[model samples]
Target: MVEETIKLAYGEYSDLIKDKRIAAVQALSGTGACRLFADFQKRFSPNSHIYIPVPTWSNHHNIWRDANVPQRTFHYYHPDTKDLDFASLMDDVKFSQNAPKGSFFLLHACAHNPTGVDPTEEQWKEMSYQFKVKGHFAFFDMAYQWFASGDPEKDVKSIGIFLEDGHLIGCS
Candidate 1:
């Protein structure tokens, strides 16, 4: 089961591994995936912190915090606008520049819970570039891939963007 999961998780992109540039793991689901990553991060990089989106799934904060990973929040949802605060989010990504570079960032791949807001493809492209420039690790939780368009892969467009930029990402 473990090997199958790993293969399924990474096999689609054989090109990535042939280049000796990718590592990955299998997770049970969204919560399990987040916990596994949190544990790995805490074990290897005790001083590092994980950034969570404001108004994210309630379990996300608990998952990381329980694993002893320091938690930080980047501006995400805008209550007034009922949508993504793009400018603030960009600033938050830039703020990671001052953080201990190479920190972890948790991103909802699609159907962001509670708000149902997602970045347009162009925004995701910019975000992928920002993660590249900032050297931040992106942890994608594609818990609801069917939410955006009733097509799983279509909802994963954001993850595709990150992959195109060669970001080392973990997904369930």
Candidate 2:
């Protein structure tokens, strides 16, 4: 089940899958997965902080807090337009008075909670490029895998983009 799940998210032909580079474990649920990752992040990157987007799932805050991981907020939703605050988000991602290089970010893989807005493929590519340039780490919350496009394969395009850019990512 774990292997199959990894293939579903990372693509069946992914070299990471074939090379056994992914470390995965089954969790009770999406919240469980997120909490486990938070714990792992706190344990491994003790001094690092997690950058979460504003207007995300409320549980995100609680989970990270319980894990004792420091939290930082980045722009995400624009209340006026009811859409993504792309410019501000980019500014944060680029570390403009926000997180530093090698910072960890929590990204919604698709069907972002509450807002239901997902970045376009081009935006994902740009984000991946910036992440590479800034040495940022992406921790994807893929709880709504097929909810964005109604196709699991297509919904995971963001992750694929990061992978294509040679990023070692974490997904839940």
lDDT: which candidate is best? 2
Give the root-mean-square deviation of each candidate in angstroms. 2.6, 1.0
The runs of at least 3 residues in candidate 2 whose Cα sits more than 4 Å from the true structure, single-residue gaps closed, are none
Compute each candidate's TM-score over C-alphas.
Answer: 0.86, 0.97
User: lDDT of each model, Cα atoms only?
Assistant: 0.81, 0.92
* Candidate 1: Cα lDDT at 16: 68
Question: Candidate 1: where are CA atoms >4 Å away?
Answer: 1-14, 17-26, 96-100
> lDDT per residue, candidate 1, 15-83, as tens digits?
766776655555676688779988988988788888888889999988988999989888889999999
